[model samples]
Target: MKFLFDIFPVILFFLTFKLYDIFIATAVAIVAAIAQIGWLWLRKQQIEKMMWINLAIIVVLGGATLLAQDETFIKWKPTVLYWLIASVLLVSSLVFRKNLIKLMLEKQIVLPVAVWDKLNLSWTVFFLLMGAVNLYVAFSFSVDIWVTFKLFGATGMMLVFIILQVMVLGKHLKPMPERIQTVNEQDNLIEKIDNKAGKK
Candidate 1:
């Protein structure tokens, strides 16, 4: 439910962005994020700290875009968002018993504490790397290429990362899904046939 609630604003942002400029899109996302916070409060859910961070970045970046009427401000927002999140992740690792990312995902994954720490470190490093890549693309590359890279290249890299992680953790992961595993009755059937022949 929380996950579904989270995507609602992203969907809204896509729609608004399609119909308007970068400034309007940024503003819409900010407004939607605020609404999401309100919804969380009303439902008695703990507001995510990352959501607050995201909100602050959106508000500041969106304000700048509006004030300057420059799409560059909005364009650079992704770089800012990535780096800021990465910094927070690293800081959390240093200050807390568990990194915040690990805490957020702990309920879904029943990994050992050491595994959690490893996961936290991996995510921290990945975010930092991604942040640097985003900064490079946004500031140094052509605007069209930067936008395209952000939309497509980043997603592709993330998918690859997930595949790599799964492969690396195959031994530690749960066995094949029950539905996909065939029952091993052949050996039993053969044993029963041989016993009947011997009795005869």
Candidate 2:
């Protein structure tokens, strides 16, 4: 699945850390990220901007972590990526007068402008909060705990957030015309019954 491909680097990083150490895991992550991007290129697939950003961060931060033999740089990678995404959402919404979330999802969903704006803002805030949370866990915990947080905490939070977003979107979804007409007719009949009861 595409989801598995996107997260292949992180998965490798976690497994490597479990087997060896942070430096080796960081090195593995760097290689995996580059390989992922190269594979996409060879397939002639259009890489998403987020994927490019991820590769850049992995190479730069992960490389620094390996070269300096410091786990700090690699630890910051997720926070950096999260903040970058937050910035993109904020800038696109405020500066460009566009909702990046809506732009990404418009083909798959249809909702009112207000609903789109709400979705965009919600995601922006979520990313920002996640960035801060990553830092807190990375610093406040042991390397092993931090690594677990990196893989499970971050992924779990995003999955939960997405499920919640889907629930919200369901509430704002535009009903089909037939469903709308049926609802309207039911409302009219109910109103008629209420009037007849009141008169009697």
Candidate 3:
């Protein structure tokens, strides 16, 4: 499942850490993530830019952790990644005349550009806050606690943000254009009928 694929790396990272150590766990997680991404690509999934960015960040940070012989470098990985994505979101929302999220998402979902920009800006701030929280926990709390927070806290925050977004977008999510969902529904029905006939 899509949800499991996205989360497998995080789960593996924690498990590997418990089995090995921070540096080795990061190395193993990076390998596992690459395989996961490759599987998605082979399955013809839409590989978003954010996905690639995440992979690159992991590789770089993981490598840094190995080369430096410092777990702290790896510990800061989430903080860095969160803020970097947040910065991109903020810049796109502010300077781009068009909403970057809209450009990426419009082909899949229809909504006004203003609403798209609002969503982008909200994500930007949310990511920034997530990054700040990561930094605080990583430095202020024990490393073990920070790792637990990394595994659970970020995920919890993201899910809450998504649910909140759905509520916000509900008002703004344009009624599905007949050309989109309706047409797809018809195509699926026809395919099912053809398959049933073939089986008969």
Whole-model alpha-carbon lDDT for candidate 2? 0.90
In order of appearance, the predictions have TM-scores of 0.67, 0.86, 0.81
lDDT of 3 by residue, 24-140 (tens): 788988898798779878999888676788788889988888898878887778888889988877776667665667777787778876788788888888889998899899889
Q: What ranking emerges by TM-score with the best candidate at the front?
A: 2, 3, 1
Q: How far out, in Å, is residue 60 in model 3?
A: 1.6
Off by over 4 Å in 1: 1-4, 95-97, 106-114, 140-156, 173-200
Clash pairs detected, candidate 3: none
Using lDDT, give the best candidate's number: 2
Say which prediction, candidate 2 or candidate 3, comes out ahead on lDDT: 2
Which whole-number lDDT from 0 to 100 does residue 50 have in model 2? 88
Which candidate gets the maximum TM-score versus the true structure?
A: 2
> What residue pairs clash in candidate 1, if any at all?
none
Worst ten-residue run, lDDT, model 2? 171-180
Q: Write one digit per residue (lDDT tens) for candidate 1, span 11-124.
A: 666567667755676678778889988888998989977788777877787778888987677666766777777777778788765477566765555565677677777877
